[model samples]
Target: MTVILNQSFTGISIGAVLLLIALGLTLTFGQMGVINMAHGEFIMAGAYTTYVLQKSISSAGISLLVALPLAFLVAGAMGALLEWLLIRRLYTRPLDTLLVTWGVSLMLQQLARDVFGAPNVQTHAPDLLTGNMSVAGVTLANNRLFILGLALLCALTLTLILRLTPLGRRIRAVVQNRDLAEVSGIATERVDRTTFFIGSGLAGVAGVALTLVGPIGPTMGTNYIVDAFLVVVVGGVAQLKGSVITAFALGVLQSVLEYSTTVSVAKVIVLVAIVAFLQWRPQGLYTLRTRSLV
Candidate 1:
């Protein structure tokens, strides 16, 4: 029972990280119909930003707190610039967007290699997050709990933004009917830019949380990119609540399966399950009624 409880905690922690990574991808792919293969690169950029911050500050707590906003700004700025320079031209061409973004992902990987070298770097947990607490013989790491809280907070904040704010309304309007939104005086272009920025910024924050789980590397984001996409797809694109729930579901399922089988085999089984589920319901677990971009 204790072991099971520990695994559950671990699963949720993993799920939280997945939620963060998928949040941004969902926003971009769901809202704009853009297949951004370089989304993982933005995450890599964030992890690298944290690494650099750790190096400069020499205080884990301060560096981490500082890394949060700085990583967001850096990744968001890069995302905004990329949207302007490349993604803007390929809005109507998803295949082209995929190819261009894939190329960009490769470029970013190479750039990280050139700048940060080929070795993986480690980022320490903050002093406050360095220990574990035990309850009923189940140990919970402070870092993992912090990550879970962060994920929930991010989800709530995003929900509020989308539900309660004018900008959120504009985003929804544009997603529903781009032409109508434009005609109604919504700055669709600005909305797109803002959405992309927030999406990429969320990916950056994911990268920061990721440092607590593993070593930071140029290709670190690639490790979880597929799982993140699966979360977005399985949850239903453009559905924030669905994404959050599906992420945790997959995370826990994977965790339980891993306890019984090899990690690779567990992933294969999960993939098969997701494939079967999709075959049954291609629209995903939840969907909102929105007009197609056509």
Candidate 2:
């Protein structure tokens, strides 16, 4: 029972990380219909932002806290710039966006290598997050717990922004029907850029949380990009609730499978399961209901 509980917590923590990574893709790819292969680089940028702040500041905790908002702005600005310079021109051509962003991703990786060098870097987590706590015979890592809370908080904040804010309403309007939204006097282009900013910013936040649990490096984002996309696709594009549910479900399943099998084998099993599930329901766990003719 104790082992089961521990694994479950671990799964939940993993799910939190997935949720953070996928949340941005949900906005960019899922809602906007742009295959941003460079999205992972945005995560890398956030992680590097944390690293840079830590180098300048003596306190790990202060640096981390500062990194959160700074990373978001840095990544969000990059996303907005990308949209203005290239993605905007190819919004109607997803394949072009994919190829272009893939090239951009490679460029970003090379840039990181040039700037930070080829060696992986490590961040020092604060003492508060370096310890472990036991709850009912289950040991919980403070870092993981912090990550879980941060993920939940981010999800909730995003949900509120989408559902209740004027900007979100504009974004939804543009997404549902760009032509109609423009006809209705909404600045669809600006909305698109703003949406991209928020989405990419979320990826930055995910990157910051990740520094607590893993090594930082130029190629680190590549390791999780596919899994993040899987979470978004399986959850259903544009369906926040579906992404949330799918993230945790896959996490638990992966954790359980990894306990009995090798990590590679566990990943293979999960991929197979996702493939089977998608074959049965390719629209994913949820479908968007839009009134637009297009």
Candidate 3:
């Protein structure tokens, strides 16, 4: 029983990270209809940013916290610049967007390799996050708990912004009907820029949280991108609720599979399941409203 609870707890923690990573991807791909292959690399950039803050700065604690926003800013700036330079030209062209973003991803990965080298670096969990607690004899890592809560909070905040705020409403409008939104005098360009910011910023924050749990490498995002995409795809493109449900389902399912079989086999099984689901629901599970958003 204890072991089962521990495993479930760990799976939930992983699900949270997937939620963050996929939520961003969901917006870019599902809502914005842009396949940002560089999305994963943005996460790598965030992890590296966290490393620099925690290792090189004088106050690791404060510095680490500061790195969170800095990571978001840096990634968002890069995302914005990318959108301005390349993505803007390729918008509405799905295949072209993929190719261009693929190039960008490769470039960023190589750049990270050049600057940070091939070796992986570990970021320390702060003292506040280093401890663990027991739940019915199931010891759970504190940092994992913190990450899970942080992820949930971020998800909720993002949902609220999209559901309540003017900017979010406009974004949703543009997402549903680009021509109509533009005709209505919505600043699609600014919204595009801001969307990139939010997407990249989410990656940045995910990077920081990830750094606390694993080794940071220039290409670390590669380890996560596929699964994150799967979560986004299965969750349905723009539906936050769908992303949350699918991410957690996949996470826990993957964990359960791992327990029952080898890790490699489990992943293959999970991938197959997702592929089958996509084949059945190519439009995704939670379709965003095309009309009546206003």
Task: State the local distance difference test value for candidate 2.
Answer: 0.90
The sequence of per-residue lDDT tens digits that candidate 2 reaches over residues 61-155 is 99999999999999999899998989999978877898999899999999999999989899999999999999999999999999999999988
In model 1, the runs with Cα more than 4 Å from the true position are: 290-294
| All candidates in order of TM-score, best leading | 2, 1, 3
Return the TM-score for each candidate structure.
0.96, 0.96, 0.94
Model 3 accuracy (lDDT, Cα) = 0.85
Model 1 Cα lDDT, one tens digit per residue, 132-233: 989899999999998999899989998899889999888878766788999999988999999999999998998888888889888987888889989988
Instruction: Give residue 143's lDDT in candidate 1 (0 to 100).
Output: 93
lDDT of 1: 0.89
Residue-level lDDT tens digits of model 3 in 1-294: 776777788778889999989878877775567888888889998889998887778675787789988998988888888889988887768778887888889999889889988899887777888899877898989888888887888889889999999999988888788789999999998898898889888998899889888999878888898889888778887668898998888888888888889789989999899889988987677876555643
